[model samples]
Target chain A: MNMTTRVSRLRGDRVTLAHGGGGRAMRDLIEEVFTDVFRPPGREDQARLTSEALQEAGAQLAFTTDGYVVTPVEFPGGDIGKLAVCGTVNDLAVGGARPLWLSASFIIEEGCEIALLRRIAATMAAEAEAAGVRIVTGDTKVVEKGGCDTLFVTTSGVGAIPPGRDIAAVNIRPGDVAIVNGVLGDHGATILAARGDLALSTPIESDCAALGHLMEDVIAAAPGMRAARDLTRGGLASALNEMAAEAGVTVELSDEALPIRPEVRGMCEILGLDPLYLANEGRAVLFVPEAQAEAALAAMRARPEGEGAAVVGRAVTAGRIPVVTKTAFGGTRIVDMLVGEQLPRIC
Target chain B: MNMTTRVSRLRGDRVTLAHGGGGRAMRDLIEEVFTDVFRPPGREDQARLTSEALQEAGAQLAFTTDGYVVTPVEFPGGDIGKLAVCGTVNDLAVGGARPLWLSASFIIEEGCEIALLRRIAATMAAEAEAAGVRIVTGDTKVVEKGGCDTLFVTTSGVGAIPPGRDIAAVNIRPGDVAIVNGVLGDHGATILAARGDLALSTPIESDCAALGHLMEDVIAAAPGMRAARDLTRGGLASALNEMAAEAGVTVELSDEALPIRPEVRGMCEILGLDPLYLANEGRAVLFVPEAQAEAALAAMRARPEGEGAAVVGRAVTAGRIPVVTKTAFGGTRIVDMLVGEQLPRIC
Candidate 1:
């Protein structure tokens, strides 16, 4: 049997602390769990390729760092390891960079199971490889309990920004079109479900994917696209407000154009949450010129990661606040930036 | 009063949820705390300058981000605010970057006093201004009371790296000179004292500061400096070991050349904690070429941040472990990376 296929079947066992103690258990976890999960597509010959060389792509490099202190390190659809790789790589992708290298620092809690730790590390390594990034350097420290929650992963990522394109929030402007790559609130809802508090269940999964290629396609199709932001922390509302405030323009997103899953919307309704302010681990908001809106949408929809890509909003000359909705009832309302946290640590 | 000083002293009677709400309170915190703290030494008049053009100093840019999950965000010598800026800026500094722009995100617990939140934000802002970086973008989210422990600040900083310099662990070689920036154990010892454990009393403050200029001087003097690392988590022992392992060489240190405050040493002796593994917030180890060792040392010593800089060791040809001596008894011991947590939540 091939390495990855054989390893994928061993995901049922619970993790132990021994897996993290740099022993045989740890090696197995890396080989069986991580290597299996992160095995790159089209790489049948695993022995020849070193883990480091697997992640490097292109010439120029982009490096960014992020720290994850999610209240519960292990959450539904993801854990700290998954979040670390996705978070760091997303930053590079949205910044028009191809992720290449990542250095992870794990602040583990005392008495943490070796298996759990190994699982997390192996997952991170595999995720990096899958995302075309290397787990280059790592530092581990075991903090006493309560000094840190079970595990916190801080990742420093280095990538290569494609030449001939510049993307920043300041590049946004009036008369630009805003598009969303996919449905929102899946990540946040999945997290809440994982908490087991609401007695709700849904076949929801996070849309976490490395967005570099999609962004590259969009930029290549419409080089004048002003800005691209990943809607992670503050969601669509927060991201729009930021762009409007930074670019000094008004943003108006259509109510019908926003692609939110029914499960996510229902949960938000029951929990008194606003999906606009909810987090999305795997999504992007693109600001492009009016003339290129169709091209941008077409480019996004061409990728498997952007099947739900749609034109959600546009920049206007009038108004200062971010507004939304020509509701089914023919009502309009302002979609203000979230004044408070809706669902915390959903990232 | 100047804008920063005026903003710094605007203490509130109490902190409200809005302070962490990402609205008016957050804006106030940014205007009052951050702007004041991070204002350049002589250019306070240009305090209102928010343009990125006014911020960039050098040619190449290096960006790094870190989240401060240190328990008891407020600690002796400095608090989470100072640590957030110093720790992140230090990372960039060691990478030979001149810090320019910083983005801050605050994850605050519900029911936290707005005043306390204000105090921390003010401290963070002041520190950033002091380090000559702009607080350009920020996010604030409030979790349920127990969701997060108090307040956590994540700062992402961007800086400019000098041309023709790419310092990495692989640059180190046998016979390279190792120099430490200052006295060790201050941050860890002070933290212990603050915890009120064992009633250990010492007047040591965290050695936290922006090391950008200090690094600039070192690189100017010895452009071929092999590698630089900040001795933070796992302290000096961990830092040394990681460097040696990365370079595939052995490291030897002179106990006499190592700097340890008397009170810290005494506390370490009593608590049975190896001060070597204790964390240091503000110190760094610089690996230099044999030919430029003296010049690098001279450059570092001339800076205020590196007043006590000294060459403490050299890379050796064999042995996987780092070794240090207790000069008093002529006993030698291996200085190993920390096996686990020394003190948790320390930035």
Candidate 2:
């Protein structure tokens, strides 16, 4: 753990094939930039982990992984590093697991700036700390220029789920209230603007925060919570459809009750996009029994990451379609799963 | 898992941005190609795992990750998918853990052939099944054409280490014996030939195989085994140097006793490469007490993956350098860590 003793041995400002050759250069880059920031417990090839949570009787391990290939490595509110950590963390959290440990592997293109990598590592470290997880093991590989985009990160996480807590889409029941944590499409809108392809400006930042803590709070308030899905790539619409299909129920959404930022709405309108299917990194739809809906909403609203909490829909008895939205004018329309790409590399 | 119930709904032969957008296309590709092949237990974002091994008192978890970006997605005797699984599994096995589960994430280029992806997935499934592990969770991201090579895969693994077993380089003693499972450099040589840059064809095939069962057999025979390291990117020389440095001892190898093929030796000589530094995907250097060395060798030689097992060297008192070799001519020479790239993306 004496990181200071391993002074910078890197000789160049950018990555090279040698840095991934399992040689002195690779060791130098890993030690100075990665190990120094992440501070894992050992230099072993694999991390040894033990926790009281794992020792508990009937405890289950939750494992998930995500690959981050965002267009711009660094975005307004978060970089690929933060997104990688948060995305994996949220995946675990939504499954009702206490996010614990993560392993991050980076595929860096040769000639990528060393400074940028350091920044990304720092951001990953900060985000992991805030999320109460340790990045215990990692690997780095440098590909030749043009072999890959600047950098891509794949983070896999392991969490512990307490005994008797079964949360899954199949557990969702009719009459369960669906709640969203915040306004949708901020992340998608932010990335669209950041790419500068649309030639429009906006003061929007990605809502790319980790939701483990918020989930813990809501679970505490509503023990009857059935399931939760992070509104990520396919957004709320896709999540709802999947949940409905799995539970063999129907999801009815109150279109007017959906919370969306003015800028995101404007961007969707200008681009002829439906805000319902736009991705959101930090948003999720939670299904709680009707009796505890108010408690879940209040618990979510109490957290900064969930200040925009609102009840957007409910699960009803099976109908012709999986998901439908009731408009402000009183008519209902199918809100199907996204058919094709509206935006690529949004995560 | 009722995989047959979900028939293929794929529309095209090539992957497009729509297949990575978390929509219907993505679902179709994942279900028909990935989920049907892997047959995970659930459709949730994370896998819920429970095992008697994890519930044991004093048991510890082992976690590791690696990114595979070998130049040719498909190489002689193996593809990136097979390499990805074996690399991570070997990392955990060498740490004295029984690898239990794996999470695979792929960054695939747009327009990549779907048929090729199916082949990779099938290979991964077969390998995981042979290794006694499950590919329980995964993610896929599609990058724009030219944003990445045809494909890159990153795999993370979780394993269980029973109580009282601590295998690490730091455990090496002055008299520990070093043994290798087989000949070195076949994987590196095979990749070099597969790339066709040298236009030199040889009968060499990549020695890529999972070594978890082999390690288990060795440990059962030699309970006092000190450490084990997979001879991966930097091969035997680098692994020895690392072990020597960590244990504060010197490693002395008998150059006459090194097991290497004639074709590999010729390839190394022609390319000005050192076979000692050439990578091996299925080989490992194991350290055992002198008394247990014979037992370890017998156990390894009994396995198909380790039929070429041989005593390569022994740890000795600290010398001027961390690693050295005794030549056939009875002269000693230092064998330091590799300094730079010998073969890029040799994985």
Please compute the TM-score of chain B alone for each predicted structure, in the order given: 0.85, 0.98
Residue B306 lDDT in candidate 1? 90
Which predicted model would earn the best lDDT? 2
Mark the regions of model 2 whose C-alpha exceeds 4 Å error after superposition: A1-7, B1-7
lDDT of 1 by residue, B1-347 (tens): 53543334334554445454333444555455444444422111101112232222323445455567665677777888888788777877887777766656565666667667667877777777777766654445555565457776776665555555677767888899999988987887877787776676677888777787788899999998888888776678877776777688888888888888888889899989887777787899999989999999899899888988988888888674555544656777787656534666566
User: Candidate 1's error at B127, in angstroms?
Assistant: 4.6
lDDT (tens digit, per residue) of candidate 2 on A306-345: 9999999999999999999999999999999999998998
Candidate 1 — which residues are off by over 4 angstroms? A1-77, A91-107, A111-114, A120-142, A152-178, A241-257, A268-274, A313-322, B1-67, B92-106, B111-141, B153-178, B219-228, B243-252, B286-297, B310-342
Q: For all the predictions, what are the DockQ values?
A: 0.11, 0.90
Error of 1 at B336 (Å): 4.7
